[model samples]
Target: MVSLTERTRQGWLPLFVLAVGMSMIIIDATIVNVAVPAILADLRLSATDVEWINSIYSLMFAALLIPLGRTGDVRGRRRMFVLGLVVFLAASALAAASVSGPMLIGARVIQGVGAAMVVPMTLATINAVYTGSRRVIAFAVWGSVIGGMAAVGPLLGGWLVTDHGWRWAFWVNLPIGLLVLAGATRVPETRDPSAGGHDVPGVLLSTVGTSSLVFSLIESQRYGWGGSSPVPYAFALAVLALTGLVLVERSRARRGRPVMLDLSLFSISSFRYGGAAATVVALGEFGMILVLPLFLQTAIGFTAFQTGLIIASLAAGAFLSGGIVPRLAKLMPARRIVQLGLLCEAAGAAAIGLVVSPGLGPWTFVPWLALYGLGVGFASAQLTSVMLAQVPSRQSGQASGLQSTMRQVGAAIGVAALGGVLVTGLGGAMERHLPDRPDLARAVRDSAGAAIAGIREPATRAAAVEASAEATRRVSLVTGAVLLAGVGAALLLPDTGGRRREEE
Candidate 1:
C-alpha cells in the first residue's frame, strides 16, 4: 500500500482540484443573492417567492449532506465527487435556461443535491491524502478557499448579472465544472475500509426533518403563525420528524449497524462546541449577505457591478487573513484566535448598522465590510481544524459532512429568520409612514424592488427607500447580536495550540 507520505509528495495539485470543486458549490450558495432582484423582476416573483429561490438550495443541501457523506465512505470518495460534478453541471445548465421562477428553483434544488455529494468528499479526500503538518496546511488552504469563494460569489454574480444577464450567473459554471471534472481524475480513490450497509431510515428521517424545519421557518413570515396559517402545523411536524430521527439513530446504535451520523462524536467538547460556533458564524454571515445586496440596489441605487465591487472588500480582507492564519496559529492558541475573530465580526456588524443610511453611498460601507470579512477569515480558517482534531482519519467523511450540515442549516435558517426581520421591518416602516394607503403598503411589503418600480411619486419612492434602509439597518444589528452569541460559543472551545489531539 502506498503510504500517505508518498501521497503528500503528489504536491498541492489534488488539494487545488478539490478547492476548485468546493468553490463551485460554495459560490453557488451565495451567487444567487446578487441576481435575486433581477430574477424577481424577470419572473414576476413576490418577496416570499424570491426567498424560497435563495433558500431551497441550502435546504436541500443540508438535508442530504449526511446521507451522501455516508455513501462516499461506503462507496468511493473519488467516484462520488465525479458523479456530483456531472449532476451539478447538468443542473447548472438547466437553471441557466429556466424561463420561469419554479423552473429555476427546481434546478437549484438539484444543484444543491450535487453540492451535498461534492462538499464532504473534498475534506475526506484531503484527510486521506495528507498527514501531520502537511494536513494542517491542507486544512488552512481548504478553509481559505471556503471563505474566499463564499465572499467572492456575490462579486462574480454581480459582474455576470451586470454585463450579461441573471441567467449567465448559472451558465458561467459550465467551464469551471468541466475543468474540475478533468482535474478530479488525478485524485486517488478513498473510503472507510470498515464501512457497512447504508442507513436508509436515518437518511429518510434527517432529510424530512431538516427540510420540514427549514420550510416552516421560511414560510412563517408569509403565512401568519395563527389563524388558518400552516406555520404552527409545519412546526409541529418538524418537531415530530426530528424527534423521531433521534430515536431511530439511538436504536440503530444499539444494534451496531452503520449510522448516517455517529452521534457519539458530539461527546467530544471540541467537536460539539466547534460545530456550534461554526453554525452561529455561518448564520450571521450568510444572513447579512442575503440582505445587503437588496439594500444596495433598491435603497442606495447601486448597480450590480458596483454592488459586487463593494462586497469584494469583504473578500479582500478574508484573503489577506486566510493567508496569514497558518503563521498566526504557530504563535497563539486557536481558541483565543477564534474569539478575537468573533469579536471583530461583532464590532464590524455594529458599526455598519449604526452608520447605515439611505443617503450613504457604497464607499461608506467598504471599511465595515472589510472588517467583517477579516473576522470571518480568522474564524473560518481555524474552526474546521479545531472541530476535526479529535476524530480519527477513517471518520473524516462523517465529520466533514456534519460540519457542512451545520453550516448549511445555519445558512437556511439565517435566510429565513433574518429575512423575516427585514420583511417585517419593511412592513412596519411602510405602515407607519403611509397608514392611510393599505393597498400600497401591502404592495411595498411584498417586494421592495417592485414597490419602488410602481411608485411614480418621487416623495413616496424616497420614503420607501428610507424604509428599506431602516429595515436593513435593523437586520444588521440583529446579525451583530448573533455574532456576539457565537463569541460565547467560541469561548467553550479548548485552547489547543493548533494541533490535532487523539480522542481520549
Candidate 2:
C-alpha cells in the first residue's frame, strides 16, 4: 500500500480528488432549487412536500455530521469517504427514478446521509494528508469550493434541467462520483490511534434534536406555526432533546469519555463569534438561493436556463473575490475582510428586495447577486480562517467538525425559515387579493410559487404574479436582515489576525 507520505507527496492529486468529491456533494444540495419548478410539473408536489424535498437533504446532512465525522476519525477517513461516494451515487440514481413525492423525498434523505458521511471526512482527510503551506492552500481551496460551488449549482442545474430534463441533474452526478472514486487510491488513509468509545447517547440526542428542529421549521410553513399542526410539538422535542444532548455531551467530556462535540471549544472567542456569523450568513445566502430561482422563473418569466445564467453572477463574483482576498489579506485583517464581505452581501440582498417586481426583468438581479457573491467569497473564506485560528492543533479535527455542523445547521434552517416566509406570505396575499379564490391561492402556495408562471387566466395569473412578487420581496428582505445579523456577529469577533498572517 502507498504510504501517506508517498501518496500525498505525489503533489496535489489527493486534494483534487477530495475537492471533486466535496464539490459534487455541495452542488447536489442547491441543484434542486433551480429544478423545483420542473420537478413540480412532473411530481405534482404540494408546497409542504416541496419544502421537504428542498430541506430534508440538508437537515439530515447537518444532524449527522459531528457523529459521522468522529466515526471517520476512528474508522479510517478514507474508508468513510469512499463509502459516502458510493452511497451518494446510488442515491442520485434513485432520485432520478423517483416516481412520487415520497419517493423523491426518500431519495433526498439518503443523499443527505451520503453527504453527511462524505463532507467531514473530506476536511479530515485533507488535514491528515497535508502540512504547512500545502495544508493552508488545500484548505483555502476547500473554502472556495464551499462558497463558490453553492452559487454555481443553479447554473449547472438550470442548464441540465432546461435541456435534458431535471432528472439529468441527478444523472450528471454519476460521472463526477466515478471520477472521484478512480482517484481515491491516491488519497492517503488516516485514523486516530487514540480515538475510541463512541458517544451513542449524544449521537442519538443530537440527531433527534436537530432533525426535529428542522422538521418543525420546514413544516411550520404548511401546518401553521401555532395551530393543530405538529410544529409546536416538534419544537418542544427539539428543545428538550437538544438540552439533553448538551448535558450528555458535557458529562461525557467531564468524565474523560469520547464525545461527539467538545463544548470547551466555545471558550475560544473567535470560534464562538466566528461560528455564529458563519451560521447566519449561510442561512441568509442559502435561503435566498432557494427563493430566487422560484421567483425568477415564476414571476419574471425567465426560462430555467436563463435563471441559471443570471444566478451564476453570484458564483462569478465569488470566484473573482477568491482571487482578490489573497491580495487584500496583506492590507487588512481577515476579520475586517470578513465583515466587509458580509456587508456586501447584506447590501446586495437589500438591493434585490427593493427591485423585485413582476414587471422587472430578471437581469435586474444580476449585479446585486454578483455583489452578494463577492461578499460570500470574502466572508466565507476569511470567516473560516478566523473561527479556526485560535483552535489548538490537537483539537483541529474536532473544531472543524463542529464548525461544519453549525454551518449545516444554519443552511438547513435557512431553507425552512425563508421558505416558510414565502409560503405564508403568498397565502396572505391570496387572502387579501383573491378572497373569493381561496382554492386558487392554496394551489399557488402549494406549488411553491411555481403555478404563477403557467396560470393562463390573465387576471388570475396577474394576481398570482403579484402575490409571488410580494412573497419574493419578503424573502429577499428577510435574507438581507439575516445577513446583516451575520455582519453584526462578524463585528463581535476579537481580532483573528494570526490565522492568515502567515500568508502575508
Candidate 3:
C-alpha cells in the first residue's frame, strides 16, 4: 500500500493533471458555442446541424459516463484517463482538419467518447487518493476545475475563433492533452483492487437507456411533439431499458458479482438529493452555454471576444465561489450554502431577464452574471463534495463516476432541451412575421430567430430586436426558475450540520 504521506505528496499532482485533462472537455463544450456561426459559414451547416455539433458531444459524453465510471473501478482509473486523453487528442486533430459537416460531427462524437472516459476517472481518482479534511479540500480544488474550465472556455474560444480560426479551438487541446498525459505519470494508478470484473450487462442496459433517452429528447425538436417524430417511443424504450437495468443490477448484486453501481447508494438522502440538484443545476448551466452566446453575438451584436469577456465575468464569479466554498463548507451546513447558491443563480437569472438593455454594453451583465456564478460555485461545488462523502472508500470510484455521469447527462439534456426552447420559439416568431415571403422567411427561419433580429429596416429591426431580446430574456428567467427549483431540492437534502454530512 502507498504510505499516507507519500500518497499525499504525489496525489495532488495527478489530481491537477486530471483537472487539466478534464478541462478540455468542459472548454470544448462551451467554446464551440460562439463559433457555430463561423462553423456554419465555413462548413455550410444548417441551424439544426450546428446545434448537433454541440449536442452530439454532450450526448455521447453523458451517455457513456456511468459505464465508463464503472469501468474505471474494475480497470484502472489512471489507465482510463490516459487512454481518454489519447483518444480525445486524436479526435481533436480530426475535428480541426475536418472539411465537411458530417466528418466534423463524427469527430466531435469521438471527442465526447474520450471526454466521457476522462471525466469520471478523474473524479474517481480524486476520491481514491484523498481522505478526511484533505479530501474536502481536494474536492473544492476539483470543483474549481469544473467551474474554472467552464468559465474560461468561452473566453479562450472567443480569442481563438476571432483571431486564428475556429479550428484552433480544437487544436489547442492537442498540446494540453499531451501535457496532461506527461503529468499523469507522476500520479499512481488507483482502482478498486477487489472490484472483480466488469459488469457487461449493467453497462449495456445503462448505455441503451441513456442513449435512447437522450436521443428521444433531441429528436423531439425537429419533429412536431405529437406525431411528427418517434421521440416518444424512443423515450419509452429508454425507460424500459432503465427498468431492465435495475433488475439486472439487483441480480448481479445478489449473485455476489460486483455491480456497476450499488443501488443502495441512492438510499442515502444526501447523495440522492445532491445528485438530483447537480443534474438540474447542470441543465441550467450547460444549457446557457448554448443559448447565451447566440443571444450575445446574433441578437446583441457583440463580437466573439466581447461575448467571451462577458461570459468570463460569470467564470470570475465561479472562481470566487471555488475559493470560498471549502471554507464555507467548514462553518455552515453544506445544504444551506447550496440553497444560498441556488438562490444566487435564480436572482442572477432574474436580473438578466429583466435588465438586458440593447445599447447596454457587456458590463450591464456583470453583477448578475457574477452573482449567477457565485450560486453555481456555492451549490455545485458542495454537491460534489457531499455526494462523494456518502460512499465508503471502496465505492468512491463508482460514486465519483455517478456524480460525473449525472452532471454530464444534465448538461447534455440542458443543451438539447433548453436549446430547443430557443430554436422553436425563434422559428415560430419569424414565421408569423414573414408570411408570403417564404424565401426571406426561410432565411429568417434558417437564422433561427437571429436573422429576424438582424432586419435593417429601423422600425422592423427595432421590433425584431426587441422580440429577440425578449426571447433571450425569457430563456434566462425560465432557466433561472428551473435553478430555483434546485434550491428547493437543496432544502430537502439532509443537513450534515457543522462538519461533513457523512459524519452526521
Candidate 4:
C-alpha cells in the first residue's frame, strides 16, 4: 500500500494545477464589472447589449454544467479540463480583439461553455483523489480559491482597466491559461466506466431550463416583469423545461438506465440542506460584490484602481480565514462552522450598510469588509465538504456541477434582484431629491450607479451622491438579509464530523 508520505507528494502538484484552473473560471465571473464602463465606451454598447455581456457568461455557464460534468464522467475528466482551457484561451483572444459589443458578448458566451467544462472536473478530481485530512485541506484550498479570487478579480480588473485598458483584462488570461495548460499533465485522469450512456433528452431539457431561468432573471433588471418584454415567457419556459427534466430523469433512473442528475442524491440530507445554504450564500455574496465597487467609485469618487485596493480587504480577510479554518474544522462539524460564518457575513454587511456617506473614508469599510471575507472563507470552504460528504466518488462530478449551478443561478438572481432594487431605490431617492429632472434620474440608474460623480453642479452632485449612498445602504441591508436566510438553511444541515475517514 502507498504510505501517507508518498500520497502527499503525489497529490500536491496536481492539486495546485487544478486549483489554478478553477480560479480562472471563478475570477472571470466578476472581473468584468470594474471594466464595464470602459467596455461600454469602447464598443459603444447599447444598454441591452451591456446586460448581455454581464449576464450571458453566467447563463451559459449555468446551463451547460450538468451535461458537461456527465460528459466528463463518461469520457475522461482531465482531457475535458485541458480542452476547456484551450477553448477558453481562444475565446479570451477573441474577446480581447473584439471591435463591437456583439462580438465581445459572443466571445463571453463561448468562454462560459469552456468554464462549465473545467469547473466540475476540478472539483470532481479533488473528491475522487483526496481522502483523510488531506481531502479536508484540499477542499479548504479549493473553496478559498473560489471565495478569494472572486473578490481579487475586481482589484485586478481595476488595475488593468485603469492602466492597460479594458481589452487587457481579457488579454491577461492568455499567459495564465497557457501556464495552466502546461501544468495539466500533473492532474490525474478520472471517469466512471459504469456511469452508462448519455440521456440526450435530459441534456436538452436541463440546458433549455437553466438557460431560460437565468436569462429571465437577467432581463428583469432592464425590462422588469409583466410588461412588454420576454421575461414572463422565458421564466414560464424554464419552469416547464425543468419539470420535464425531472420527470425524464426519474423515469430513466427507475428503469436502471442512464441519467444526467440522479434524483436520489437529494435523499442525502447533507447534500440537500447544504446546497440550499450555498445558493442563498452566493445570492448575497455576489450582489455585494457587484454593488460595492460601484458605490465606492460613483458616490465616493474613487478611481477604479483605488476602489479595487479598498475592496482587496475582503480578499485578504478570506485568505487569512483560510489559514485558520482547517484547525477549526478539527474542532467542529462543517454545518456549524458554515452557520457561524454566515452569521458573521450578515453582521458585517449590515454594519457597512449603516455607515455609507460621501465623506466616509475608504479605509472605514476595511474592517467590516474583512469580517465579511472571513465569513465567505469559512462558509465557502466548508460547504463543499459538507455537501459532498456522503456522495460516492463516482458521482462527484454530477454533485459538484449541480452545487456549482445552484450558486451561479443564485448569483444571476442576486445580480438581477439586487440590481433592480438599486435602480428602483436610486430612482425614488433621485425623484425626491430632484423631482423636476427625470432624465437625470434615468441617467444615474442606467449607468449602474456610475453617473452620480459626473454631475457638474455642486448641489446636484451632492444630491446624486446622497441618493447613491442611500441606495447602496439598501443593497447592503438586502445582502445581509439574504445571508441570514442562508444561515437558516445551513442550520438544517446534518453535521458530517470534521476529518471524516481521515488518517493522521
Which candidate number would show the highest TM-score if scored against the true structure? Answer: 1
TM-score of each: 0.97, 0.95, 0.93, 0.94
- Give the whole-model CA lDDT for all candidates, comma-separated: 0.85, 0.85, 0.78, 0.82
lDDT of 1 by residue, 192-230 (tens): 887778888888888888888888888887888899998
lDDT of candidate 1?
A: 0.85
Sort by TM-score, best first. 1, 2, 4, 3
Q: List the residue pairs that clash in candidate 2.
A: none
* Model 4 C-alpha lDDT versus the unseen true structure: 0.82
The runs of at least 3 residues in candidate 4 whose Cα sits more than 4 Å from the true structure, single-residue gaps closed, are 1-9, 44-49, 145-152, 499-504
Clashes of 3: 0
Measured on C-alpha atoms, candidate 2 has an lDDT of 0.85
Comparing 2 with 4 on lDDT, the higher-scoring candidate is: 2
Task: Point out where model 3 deviates above 4 Å.
Answer: 1-5, 432-442, 450-460, 497-504
RMSD, one per candidate, in order: 1.5, 2.5, 2.4, 2.8
The 10-residue segment with the lowest total lDDT in model 4: 495-504
Clashing pairs in 4: none
Candidate 1: misplaced stretches above 4 Å?
A: 1-3, 150-152
lDDT of 2 by residue, 96-196 (tens): 99999999999999999999889888877776677665766776787676657666787888889999998987988999899899999878887766677
Query: Which tens-of-lDDT digit does each residue in 1-504 have in candidate 4?
Result: 233355456858878889888888766765677777667656765445656786677778778888888888878889999999999999989999999888998999999889889988998878877887778878988877666666677689889989888888898888888999999887777786567688899989988997788778767767778768899999999999999999999999999999987888798788899889988998888777777877787678777788777777887788788888877867877888899899999998998898887689879899999999888888888888999888776678889889988887787667766767777788888888888889998888777656775688999999898888899999999999999999999989997784342311
